[model samples]
Target: MRRLRIIGIGAGNPDHLTLQAVAALNTLDVVFLPDKGSEKGALRALREEICRRHVTRPDIRMVPLAVPKRAEAGNDYRGAVDDWHAALAEAYERLFRDHLAEGETGGLLVWGDPALYDSTLRIVEAVCARGLALDYDVIPGISSVQALAASHRLVLNGIGESVLVTTGRRLAQEGFPQNAGSVVAMLDGEQAFAAIDPAGLEIWWGAYLGAETEILASGPLAEVSEEIRRRRAEARAAHGWIMDTYLLRRSR
Candidate 1:
């Protein structure tokens, strides 16, 4: 039987690697790195850097995998995602057969916590369902939401108030969550915060968090929304890709 370890490397920072994650890295016979194309080459580079800085073993081999792009948006978004994951499962099976030896351990360094907005676990499940013989374990690390709150120097929730984590599309469509005092939005490419009423709201936004290109903006939503949008656009243009997260709070 083969073993797979899904290690969370934290958000864009080499220091974010936990001691456990480092140990896991050292034990792996092979490490799989996903290439998300030229636009996100920096992401791939970061993973390489982490291995260089932490993996002391000389025998560990690094393997690069081309990540398949999802189909363009249509009426069936879930269906499109299903198709994409299926393709990824096939790719994983081939990689394992080619690179991994029987009874050897392999690893995938996932950004942030694997349990967050990531789909690596789901893809692995799909791979197993498709007949790959493997057992896996998850090692948790800091998430973007945690990084955002830490960078902003604020608590995620008020006294006795709850927080909700959701996507940009839902934020744009649902306005704001009525049940929670704080909302953390991820994977929002459309600047969905712009659609909401800025009055009585505060936002803590960060881009390229924990990296050299990091940017932060906060204050009353009406006062800082335009600046955030402008800065986000500028950063995206400069980097060719951006990963950002924000915390929205209702003023008490």
Candidate 2:
């Protein structure tokens, strides 16, 4: 019997931390952070900074847990992810039992909102599936998709049209949806938009959304397609890593 509070910490800006997130951080008995095992600890460092700023020895335990790498075992994509989630859940349960008090409050700082493309909620659910009784409270934070739209000063959806939020993989393999407009592509490590016909498509791309090293590019995809690829490579090389999101529109 323990209470888990999963708080969204926004993209990469300290200002993205909501007042509610700060309050939750101040009262938690323990906070679990996932380490990516790379020097690109921007996310982890940001989480640490939030704790350092909001909680002054706030009786909160900070658990830096190492995340297991995704499996490339077979051609079964869904199975690999499923197995990974199961392993992640086991890790969390071990941390909870070792550092958290029974029926006490614990927190997990998730990047962006948990409801978005984040997997923290899935990891938490995995823990619950093991019959570990706990109630979870989620605090919504600004999503990078919102930040991307805001950065470009463009509305995500027009007056009556719809918006499709998708990943780079889908964008690459499935191509643009028939007649769909305003697509937001995220977690695209492979530059999936290259698969689509750049004609009539406009792109708004940003890396490290709100961070100081942020890079923003926008224009006709046909004109800036190669530019974006070059910029993305440069930014990644300069920083040793990068987190980018982009929005593509099929005209107004």
Candidate 3:
């Protein structure tokens, strides 16, 4: 059975690839790069750049795999995501068949850490279900959580308060989490912060984080919320797609 190593490259920055991740990148027999066609090819290109910088061997193979577009599930979002993971796992297995022999090392450069809001881990589990005994290893890297904090120079949690990390959908359907002093929101297609009470609330927002064209806006929600939305739309239209995360905190 071949081993799969999922390495985190951080948010679009080549320098964010740590030495440990660089070692793993160099060690892998084949690096599987996911190409979401032109819409999201920037991600794959960034990964390729990392390899070009860190990979010493000219003989090392870089494989570009076509990622499947997810089908919309009307309801049962979890089930829908699970089905998509299953399909992605099958795609991965098929790609490995031609590239990997038993016990070979395979690597995937996952955006951000694989443990946080990432489907790569679930997809790998589905791959293992197909009767392939697998050796799995994950190399954690700087996540968007860290990026948000670094960009804003704010800690995720206050001195003694708990922090809640959630999706935009959850933040919208449900209000700000009870008893949480800080909230980090990601994967929000809609600007969910507008639904929260803006009184005494502060927001740190960044789009295309860690990229050359990164944009950041932060201030009291009442003052910056509309600006973030307007800037975000303009950036998305200019760049085709955008990856962003934000932090919200309510004044004590």
Candidate 4:
């Protein structure tokens, strides 16, 4: 049987690699790096940097896997995602069969914690469902939410309050989670913050977090929303791609 380790490398920081993640890296026969097109080259470089800094073993092989692009947004968003994941599963199956030997340990370094806003685990499940006999383990690392809060020097929730982790689409469609004291939005390419009423709400936002090119903005939503949007656009234009997260807090 083959073993697969999904290791979280944290948010764009080599230092975010945990001791356990380092150990897992050292034990792997091959490390699968996903290339998300040229626009996200920086992301791939970050993973390579993590391996360079942490994996002491000189002979370990790093394999670059070309990721399939997802379908353009349409009415059936779920169907599009399903088709995308299926294609990824086929690619992953081929990678493991051709590159990874049976009984050997292979690894995939995921950005941030694999459990949050990441589909690696789900893709792994899909691979297994396709009859790939493999054992797997998940090693957690610092998530973007934590990185955002840390960069802003604030807690995710207020005293005895709940926080909701959601997507930009949900934020736009559902307005806000009425019961949530705080809402952390991820995978929000739409700048959904612009759609909400900024009054009485404070926002902490960060882009390229934990990386040297990092950007941070916060304060009353009305005061900083446009500034954040401007900065976000500037950063994206400069870097070709950006990964950002934000926390929205309501006045109690």
Query: lDDT by residue for model 1 over 50-164, one digit each (tens)?
Result: 9989999898999989898989869888899889889999999899889988899999999899999888999999889888899899999889888998899889999898999
Of 1 and 2, the candidate ahead on TM-score is 1
> lDDT tens string, model 3, 43-133?
8778878988999967778887888877787888888877778889899989888788898888989988898998888888888899667
In candidate 4, which residue ranges exceed 4 Å CA deviation? 37-39
Instruction: Tell me the TM-score of model 3.
Output: 0.95
Models ranked on lDDT: 4, 1, 3, 2
Using lDDT, give the best candidate's number: 4
lDDT of each: 0.90, 0.84, 0.86, 0.90
Q: Which pairs of residues collide in candidate 4?
A: none
List ranges where model 3 is wrong by over 4 Å: 37-39
Candidate 4 matches the true fold with a TM-score of: 0.97
Query: What TM-score against the true fold does each predicted structure earn?
Result: 0.97, 0.96, 0.95, 0.97
**Range of the 10 consecutive residues with the lowest summed lDDT in candidate 1:** 36-45
Between candidates 3 and 4, the TM-score winner: 4
lDDT of 4 by residue, 25-93 (tens): 989999998988544677778787887788888888888899999989699999999999999999999
Over the full model, what C-alpha lDDT does candidate 3 score relative to the true structure? 0.86
- Candidate 1, residue 42: the lDDT equals 69
